[model samples]
Target: MVGRGRPPPPPQVARDEGIRPRRRNMEDEENMYGKLKFNMPKFKGEDDAEAYLSWALKVDKIFRIHNYSGAKKVAMASLEFEDYANTWWEQVVTLREEKGDPPIDTWEDMKEEMQARFVPTHYKTDLFNKLQKLKQGTKTVEEFFKEMELTMMRANIQESENQTIARFFNGLNYPIKKIVEFQQYSNMVELVHQASKAERQVNEDIKYSKSKQMIRGGLWTPPPQDRQALLVVQ
Candidate 1:
C-alpha cells in the first residue's frame, strides 16, 4: 500500500527485470543472424567434391536453423552461381527443362545428382598415393602437414595418434625429422606444435646464416667487369 503511492513504477519497467524490450530483442536476434551469409565456395566438380559437399551441408544447416526448411529455391539459386563444369551444368539444365514444370523439385535430388557426378568412387587409392608422395620439399612444415590433412579427409582415412605421428614423421625433412624423432613425443598434436617451433628455429638459423654471409660480403658482389679484372690481376 505504501509502494502503491509510487505510481506502480511505469508499466514497461515493471514487466520484468532481465527481459529486454520486445523490439530490441528482435533486433538482437537479427544482428546475431545477419552475420551469417551463405558464402560457400563454388564447386568445380570432381577432385573438389568433398570441399563443395562440406560447404553445402553447412549452408543447408544454417538455413534449417533459421527456419528456412527444405530451402529448395535458395539451394538451387546458390548452385546456379557455382563453377560446375560447363558440360555438366548444361546437361543438368537440359534434363530439368525436359522434365517438367518445377525442373529439379528438391534440394535433395540436386545434391544426390551432384554427388553422383563429382564424388570419386575410389578416393582411398588417390589419397594413399598422395600421402605416399607427400614430402616437405619446397613447403614449410605447416604447409606439408596441412596438405596431408586434406588428403586424409578426402581419403576418409582415420589413423590412431601414434599412426598420425608416424605418418607426419615419415614426411618431415631430414634435420627436423631427426630432431623430432629424438624428442619422442607421444601425442601427434604436441609433436606437430614442436615441429612447427623447430621449423621456425631452423628457418631463423638459416636466415641468420645468410645475413652474416651478406654482411661479410657487404651484400653486393663486384660487377662482372671488376671480377674479371680482379681475376686477371690475381
Candidate 2:
C-alpha cells in the first residue's frame, strides 16, 4: 500500500477500565454524603459538658459507619455546627491561621480542640467522681454497664482490662458479686455476663422462695385436731 494506514483506535475496554474505579468512588462518596445529610446532628454550643460529649459520641458513630478519612471526618462534623458552635469553630480556625498553626485535619485533633474550647476543666474530674461512686444498686446489670461505659468514654479514662473487670465486679450488687467473684473472668464482657447470670439466679431464687411462702400461707390448713383445739380455746 502506498499510504500508511491510520493507527488503530484505542480499545474501548482499556478506556473504560481507568474510569470504572473513579466512577465507583464518586458514587460511593455521593451515597455517604447523602446519608450524612440526614444523620448528622447539629451542635448548639450548650454549656453542659455532657451535651457536648453526647454530640461527639454521636458524630463519631456516624464517622465510623462511613469509615471516612480524617480530613473528611473533620469536614463533615464541622458542617453540622450551629449558632454559637459554628461561630466558635470559625474563630478557632481564623486564630490558627493568624498564629501560623497547622489546620485541624484529623478527627482526633478536631475533638481535642472542641473539648478544650467547649468543655470546662472540671468536666473530667466530675466524670471521674461520678464513676467512682457508681453502683448497680437497683439498676439491671445492662443498665449499670452502659452507664459505666458512657462515663468512661466521656471522661477519657483508660484502664487495664483487669482493672475494668474489677471495677465492674465491685459495682455489682452484693448478691450478684458474691456469686460472680469466684468465677473466672478475663474481660469486662465476661464479668458482665457472669454477673447478669448471677442476678437472674438470685431473682429466681427469691421468686421461688416467695412462691413457697404463698403455698404455706394460703394453701396449707391446720390439722383437724389442731383446729378443734383452737376452736375450743376461742
Candidate 3:
C-alpha cells in the first residue's frame, strides 16, 4: 500500500505553483488598468457645458470599448480627473459619506452626478435653440448632417424616425431640399443618402455652368475697338 502512491510536491514547489496564478492575475489587472488610464480623457471641471459633454462622450466611448463593469468604469474615469474636477470628485465622496448614502458605483449614476455639477441648467435649452436654427449654410451635406446629429444628442432629443427625418430634411439647403423633397424615404439614413446625392448633382450642375461660361468667355474676341486692325490682319 505505501509503495502504491506518489509522494507530494516539495513545500517550495507547492508555494511557487500557488503564487504563479496570482502573480499572473495581478500582472493582467495592472496591464488592463494601464491601458484604461492611457485611453481615458481627462476632465478639468471647465465652466463650459459643451466641454463637459464632450469629455463625457469620450469617456463613455472608452468604457464601452473596454466593456468595463459599472464599478470599474467609475473608478477608471475618476482617475482621469484633474484640477477642479479632482476636487469636485473628492467633495462628492465626502458629501455622500455625510449623508450616509452609498458611494456612486455605477457609470450612469456618476455621469448624472457630474452633469448636475458641471452642466448648466440652461445648457440643454441653448443647445435646443441652436438646433432649431441649424442650417446647411455653406457646410457640405455631410458636415451639416453631423452637426445636426451632434446637436440632437447633446440636447437629449427623442423623436420618431419620421420626425427626425423631417427635421434633417428641413435643415437642408433649398436646392438639395427641393430635389430630396420629392424622394420617398422611410428612415433618416435614406433621407441623408438622397440629400447627399442631390448635393453632388447640384455641385456638378454648378461646375458645368461655370465651365460653359468660361468657354463662352474664351471664345469671345472682344468686338474689336480694333475692327480696322482685325480687318488688316485678316
Candidate 4:
C-alpha cells in the first residue's frame, strides 16, 4: 500500500497511544448541589394529616399544657418544664447573682441537682380524671382534648419518646387513616406542679381559645408598659 508510510497501524491502536483520559474533568464534579429557588410555604387543610402534624409541633413548643387534652396535657406540660427546670435551679444554686456566671456544666451536676431540687407543684387535678376516659374508648384524642377544661392546644413529647409512641401506634395499624380524629404519634409528659399553681395575671376569664399569648409568669399587663411585646431574649 502506497498510502502513508506505516498507514496509522489501525485507528484504534493509534488512538490508544495518543489519547490520555481527557484529564479527570474536575469542572463537572465540582458542581453538585444544583440551583436554589424561592418558593412559598404550604399549609394543609383540616382533614390533612399535615395539619395535625403542624398542630402537634406547635403544641410541643409551648411551656404549659393546660390544654383540654387530659393526661396528654399533663404529659406535654411536664415535658416542656423538664429541661428548663434543670437549668433554672442550676442558676439558683450559685446563690449570688454577682458575675452571672454559670455554676453547673456537667451532666453529673445536673443529675445531682435534679435529685436535690423538688419538682414544682401544680393545681389542676381533674385533668387526670378527664384523661382516664380514653380507656373507655368512648372518645377520640381530639374529642377528649376539645372537651376538657379551658380551651387547649395540641402538645408534643420528646423526640425519642415521640418516635417510640409513633412506632407503637403505627404497629396497631388501627384504620387510623379513615378516622378523622386520633393521635397518630405522640408521647406523654407529666406536670411538675398542680395546674392551679401556674398563674396568669389576667383577671378576665379568657379561655385558651380566647387568649392569644399563654403567659405563665404572673399577671399580664397591657400595652407599651408590658415589656414582653418589645423584649427579644437574644
In model 2, the runs with Cα more than 4 Å from the true position are 1-38, 64-73, 96-103, 218-234
Ranking by TM-score: 3, 2, 1, 4
lDDT of 2 by residue, 140-177 (tens): 99999999998998888989988888788889999999
Per-candidate clash tally: 0, 0, 0, 16
RMSD for each of the candidates: 7.2, 10.0, 10.6, 22.3
**TM-score per model over all chains:** 0.57, 0.69, 0.72, 0.18
Q: State how far residue 65 of model 4 sits from its true place (Å).
A: 24
TM-score pick, better of 2 and 4: 2
Q: Output candidate 4 Cα RMSD.
A: 22.3
Q: What is the lDDT of residue 144 in candidate 4?
A: 31
Q: What's the TM for model 2?
A: 0.69
Q: Which candidate model has the greater lDDT, 1 or 3? A: 3
- Span of 10 residues, lowest total lDDT, candidate 2: 214-223
The local lDDT score (0 to 100) that residue 43 gets in candidate 4 is 22
lDDT of residue 164 for candidate 2: 82
Local accuracy of candidate 4 as per-residue lDDT tens digits, 1-234 = 556665545545655554444433443333321232212222222333334345444544441322234444433323344344535543565563566766554433433444344322221233334333322134443333334312121222224655433332332213332231232222322110111112121113345524545366535555564566557532
Question: If both were scored by TM-score, which would come out higher, candidate 1 or candidate 2?
Answer: 2
